[model samples]
Target: MKANPGSAAGSPTPVVEAKPCGNTGETVTERALRLRVRQQEILAELGVRALRGTPYPELLEYAVQCTAEGLEAEFCKVMEYVPAENRLLLRAGVGWEPHLVGTASVGADLASPAGFALRTGKPVISNHLENEERFRTPELLVEHGIRRAMNVILQGEGRPYGVLEVDSRSPGEFGEQDIAFLQGVANLLGMAIERQRIERDLRAMVEEREVLLREVNHRVKNSLQLVASMLSLQANATDKPDVRHELREAATRINAIGRAHQRLYRSNDVRVIDLAAYLVDLCADLNAAWPEGEVVARTPDEPVPIATDRAIPLALVVNELVTNATKYAYPGRQDGLVEVCLDQAPEESRVVLAVRDAGVGLPPGFAPHASTGLGMRIVTAFAQQLKAELRIRPLDVGTEFSLVISLQAPDRAG
Candidate 1:
């Protein structure tokens, strides 16, 4: 039986008995063992919640409530050290007035019990707060008529965060065994708080990098556009037909690259491109370039994500194939149809891009590898760079250029 601290002066201190586990009459040793087991169970539960990454505010609240219940104490709290003010803020707690929490402060100097624990990196227990001679009792405790208290330092990798303290108003002694349980709870809370800090820092770094990358893409696209415009002006100034034709072709290719960068600048993910959408946009540009002829794009409705590095080369290749068909496919006509198709190969890990025209066929027995034309040479170089297969089929009245590219895993941002 234990004496009630709230009993009046002239009346008998009412006795409270510890309940037995069963009707068999459990011994004192058995009761102590049961209490220890229950404490261990509570610690295990807190550990699991910490590992699962529970938010720090919720985790701290749970820790204090469970610690108080495990010790059968009346009050528990987690204090955050405010180095600037040299005090501890009541960050989370139970058994305190709602208004006091998050607004109350306690001394963090060696003269106070909690302060001594934080400074020495050791736990403090004062079973008799009224007659304690080593440290002065805090006014907050005195106001609540606390008879005993325990303090444990909460620390992580570097400096100490603060302290975890439990107080009791009832008449009881806080033993050495109680310190171990309280310290365990403080350790888990410290580690969890550190993890949250690291995660927040990493997320901020990633966001900053993404913003910088998007800015770089935007600048590159503008620079390429400027260069292409300069080339177009030079092509118009030249009097020689051959020089004019070559300069215009060079400008067209530069514009294609600029368009790819523009897409990256506008996209949410800078590492990859949507092949279907890129093809549709490219076809629109080609139609505007060759208003006399029509260029049609046929692609799957679903998005096909491709790495940014490969997307530029694929766009350039498509541009070259379509250009060739529009120039030489029809001998003397102004109106012709060129089709560009993108699809996945059936039952195979490959994608096929084909450009076909129905105006005229390739010269008899012509070989792409043996061709000396600058366009064919450019196509062959880019195809080798991509490690893709290039196939040309001669139709009855025109030609079809097909590029078979092996699909690769999507690239992830580091």
Candidate 2:
């Protein structure tokens, strides 16, 4: 090995030998075979890591380091092509200044090894930088005493991403086998980059969809509130008590739906909601609807998440039960307590909702489905919509209504 004057003191400089091409010598062929075996082993390990969900940055950094070690080269780098800027930005490298790894830039011209590989979509090699005439030598390369370089283009999802290059201070360090190994490494890196980009795009799309859903929920809440306001105005203008009562009840039901949508908007997840939290807010609204009753909610520590599709009917059912408790459960009275309970029976794959009022018990021999009241009828219809079994019985001091519905578990990512 000949020592370079520019090398640091006491550091061994690599010898510049004649360039090896084709299958000219047994020495080159044997070395290529050994390198190919090592390359295959490294590629297999990297492929496994990718499948196991290893971080992309860590995998990419390992790839460059693996390439440098496998080919016995002093420097290896992965550059990302920026066509918009007409440049190649260094993304990862081995044996270069630390700041150069992520911040370095080089021109994307025929004169640069990275650019030449990208432009031609093929491999390029310069075994003798001092006397090479095909392209102008980069200043950084000369400064680092680089005597040889080999570059291969990295193709991402059938499009060009950038180039992978290996540099050595020793001339003739790269041969046909080294180029082949770097090609394989570049192909592996391309696949990893493509996967990372796809994952990022999917995340962005989901975020965008969530934002749109929240906006839609806000609009729906406003529209429902507007309808409720119109119904209130009509109720105020009515002369008949029955007509006014019916109009007000209709407005309350609409408002219930609006409140449900509001909860969905605030939760930021349109697909499902924490049933316990939703009921707490809902009962507060119901309690404030009247002047003589208070509604309290009871739930487990763990959240019971129900999908929006099923939640609407469930919300309506609770509304009717609570409304009935406040109105008739304490006939001619000025004070009462209504308790709403939500519990999940995991063993039975069911969710149970019960509304109990500490007021007058059900009238002797009274039937729920046979009731003539609009609220009771609405409750029955909603229970059927939920595919739930409705159960009604008299408590020791009041009436208790229960619904047992099938539970659908949340979906998980694979």
Candidate 3:
């Protein structure tokens, strides 16, 4: 606790005068002992009240009033340290003029009682402000007729937060007990102030972390898009049909993943993706890339939120299947129709994704497990990663590929 510059020995302005025991005829010494005990009891109760979760300002105000009432001082105040301003700001007070509670500030120099206590980490006591020589008398105290004062530093974690002080219009000496009681009140007040500071810091950290995460996702999306652009440029420049086809295909795959990252960056929650929006955007990109086929996606009215780890693989599976249908499903037509459907099972924990084409079905004697084609292999691998079953059915005039993903899997499909 901080020190007070003034001594505690002097006459007191009678804020509250000690009265004789009624009809008991008790000795002066006994009466003084009883009064001291009662004072301790009041301080103890106020200490408990201070520990409650009341607003800091209200509680601090109550604490100062309690100090004044308990010690029979006419005035009391709590001041908070502002290091940047190098001043002690009055946070709460009792018996001060109304304008002074929020407006008063004192220099945090050796001349001020609050500053003296903060510097020395000890209690300061003054019996007569008029005769005090340890520190210059503050004008506010003199204006209010304060003659006696005691102050203690409000310290937390061994660092001073501010000061708690009680003053009187009368002059009198303050005993060691008075100083000790004020110190106790300061200790309790310090704890509350510390708790608020820590909470504010934690909230700031959480907000900062969210901002950083979004920035990382945004940068990643931009970088991936750059790579996709490079692949497109390379594909357009190549003269070999097969090499150009491979590069375009690579670019589409990179662009598909980039779409997912971009969506997450724009979303409020980074941990989950709205799969419906994701599929629509993916299909739109595919239609533009492969204008020979018209790609369309259908989804439910409510949002379909998928975990981050699962959304990427799910999007890729759809991309590969739809691209294959556009390439091989329609042989003679310039514009084939490919439909992608996403639905949640009505009675089971599963998602069913179906991609269908309105053109000639798969070639005769085709087998999914034995197919050496890259598209077929990729579809099968993604199906296994999602812990879903893959099925291909030949339509009367086209082909359909379906995957039923298990939502309860221990780990998300690849």
Candidate 4:
């Protein structure tokens, strides 16, 4: 086989000369000794980069390049292991035939320096590639004119990921110092690969958790719709006008609760709910529950968002106003109007909702707020829950009930 100018094959066609270390003071020996010190420096730099946020795969490349510079060989390669196939695949490498860099691989049990090191979990120092008995492709060595090589296995977290193999065109190219220095480089490489793997796994876990939360929200929406359906059926069974009216109003209120849950449950966020949509839907349901004859409700154009806790009582207030207008305001065949309005009062950091109905004005001695009626009690309770102040004024036609609620901004209609 052709040999490198400065290297010579000391033994036979394939001879692995990993015998023992001896003190040989030559210029090459001194250079190899100096390279050992650099290997330690590279390792220190790699550690600093890891702490300072260098990516994992790039770190692997850096380590592979350092090994190549240290050995000063004709060809240097680092191959990573794939446990499923029990073979080492090339990840980072240098100084090889263009076609061989990524296109070739050596079996773990094959006759190669890497193969030998993997089988025994030890390094293989071959001074003569042609005479190496354990080499899987001794003939390839002759074909590529590779006379000698030195290989070190990188043992990572679980198993040896790859081999760092240094090659030369001549024979007996590496000594004891080369093997020792190469081993240190392999050790640092192993640690970096394992660190990268752990980081990737943690990120994957966080993403998976977020996906599960969205799925949970979807399931909750379905459950709320079922409850609304049952309320609808119950309203159908009642016969008495008073009982039927009460049941229907109850069904409407229950449906509002269900719709609120539906809106909140559909969102990716469980905390804040889109107040505009929920309020529009809820107030519409309230108006439909009992006909106001000429009383129509309206909503704001821009959307507002609010926490679920504040929204619940806010929706119930809307229910009470619509119910009161239907039950008492337009008593006979008199056509009247019940206007519902919501305006964003960000300067005050609150949302104002007012219901105006045209009917017989409140009597001078009439105490609507002091009444024992169930509807009045409910309205007062909900207003208190929102930490809002309720203002009841006698309109020329009927009465106006206005409540101002503390909210984040961008008031939603109700």
- RMSD vs true structure, all candidates: 6.0, 6.6, 5.9, 8.5
Candidate 2: where is the Cα deviation over 4 Å? 1-32, 346-349, 409-414
Model 2, 65-116: lDDT tens digits are: 8999887789988889999998888888998999998888777787776788
Candidate 4: tens digits of C-alpha lDDT, residues 278-366: 76777667656545364454667776778877777777777777777777787785355677877766656577788888877665786
Instruction: For each candidate in the order shown, give its overall lDDT on alpha carbons.
Output: 0.85, 0.81, 0.81, 0.67
| Model 1 CA deviation exceeding 4 Å by range | 1-25, 96-101, 131-145, 347-350, 394-397, 409-414
Per residue, candidate 1 scores C-alpha lDDT tens digits across 1-414 of: 564553111112323225455676777568667777888999999999999999989999999999999888999999999999999999999998878789998999998889988998878878778988888798999999999888999997788899999999987666656777888899899999888888888989888888888899999999998998899899889999989878877877887888888889888788998888888888888897788999999999999888888989988999898888888899899789999999997737579999999977888888888989888888898898888889999878789999998666433564
Badly placed stretches (over 4 Å) of model 3 are 1-76, 93-102, 126-133, 145-149, 166-185, 300-303, 345-353, 359-370, 386-414
TM-score (C-alpha, index-matched) for candidate 2: 0.88
Report how far off residue 98 is in candidate 4 (Å). 7.0
Sort by lDDT, top down from the best: 1, 3, 2, 4
TM-scores of the models, in the order given: 0.83, 0.88, 0.73, 0.59
Better of 2 and 4 by TM-score: 2
Which candidate achieves the best TM-score against the true structure? Answer: 2
- Candidate ranking (TM-score, best to worst): 2, 1, 3, 4
- Candidate 3 local distance difference test against the native: 0.81
